[model samples]
Target: MVRIKQRYILFDILSPPSSEHWEAYSESRDSALLHLHQVSSSEISAKYLLQVIRQVLQDHYGDFGAGSAGISLVVKYFSPKTSTGIIRCGRQHLDMIVAVLALINRLGDKEVIMRCIHVSGTIKKCENVSIKRDKEDIIRMQRKRK
Candidate 1:
């Protein structure tokens, strides 16, 4: 007989946005929150979470791909209200939590930080950024190659 083990990774972030803030952004925030539960372990899924973190970091720090420095920013700004003991898990899951927490700290927004901790899935790539360029920009650069 063969045995297969299922691995579970769970995290939670507690950022208590005020009623006023929630009311103002409730629709969009709720939509994003709903999507979090749908996240899964796939390249595309990891990429999407990365995209969200990148946007949050850029909005707060005005840059992306900041590496460890960025991680420091996240940890410094996002205060940890509480953290469950690190259960024995894969390094990937632990790394994801670290990266997410770092970003939350950088934002210095407790509400957002809390929400991020609860984000679904493990952040696979902590340092990769998705490059979004229009077709014209791509062609212009390709033409410049010659």
Candidate 2:
């Protein structure tokens, strides 16, 4: 039997500074994302994120070159609150995935940063850690709001 190993990469996204009245403008997660990223839509679905990542990979490596890299990537989760998400990919493609992630400085017209925070062999571990970190981020945001 042939076994395939997969790795889950967790990352946080940082966006440009919002206007002073950002609170008033951000009615929903999508709204906030749209405002922050200056994109036509606020929905950062797994499919959408994957498309963007693939585009980056393609840009760095031409279509055929990217295919030769043998990267099997998927987005597991994405949260606008913490700006954190998870990606699952073949173990062998981790380095290439990281490189592409590092090169992603812009999403649409907005300036952003995609910072990888962790990597794990299992999705459960990634989810647990992401939940913990997300809670901490929420707490920090609350403190800042006060």
Candidate 3:
């Protein structure tokens, strides 16, 4: 029997502007899609990836408004062998990011094994890292013993 391990990765755009804000919105969308494609092609399964992406979008922006608002470009990827999944949010909303991460953490205690999650965004002057890690390096470091 082939031992299979499931991994879930969540990528959020974190405040994608409406289409009216085209210049900034388009750039943000492109950057996010590129990053997700790069990450997903590595080893993630496309089917599962799509599932997560759909769920996140529905959860954040209601299914009714996604199509009309031009936020319907979310991408997903899956690996054929192991079925590893990656979900990339088309337009990132900061509040949505917070909600998604919180949900992931809650679910992490359950069945899903969150192998790797990446969130990219510009930091505002007043925010702090709740899941402390070196911002310069994407590799998350656990808290060191004092």
Best by lDDT: 2
| Model 1: ten consecutive residues of lowest lDDT | 125-134
Query: Where does the lowest 10-residue lDDT sum fall in candidate 3?
Result: 122-131
On residues 1-62, what C-alpha lDDT tens digit does candidate 3 reach at each position?
95422222333222223456555445554444333222222333454344554465466668
C-alpha root-mean-square deviation, each candidate? 16.5, 5.8, 17.6
Each model's lDDT: 0.35, 0.76, 0.36
Best-first order by lDDT: 2, 3, 1
By summed lDDT, the worst window of 10 consecutive residues in model 2 runs over 32-41
> Whose lDDT is higher: candidate 1's or candidate 2's?
2
lDDT of 2 by residue, 15-79 (tens): 75547747745666644544443322366656777888988889997786478443578898887
| C-alpha lDDT (0 to 100) for residue 75 of candidate 2 | 90
TM-score list, all predictions: 0.24, 0.74, 0.30
lDDT of 3 at 56: 59
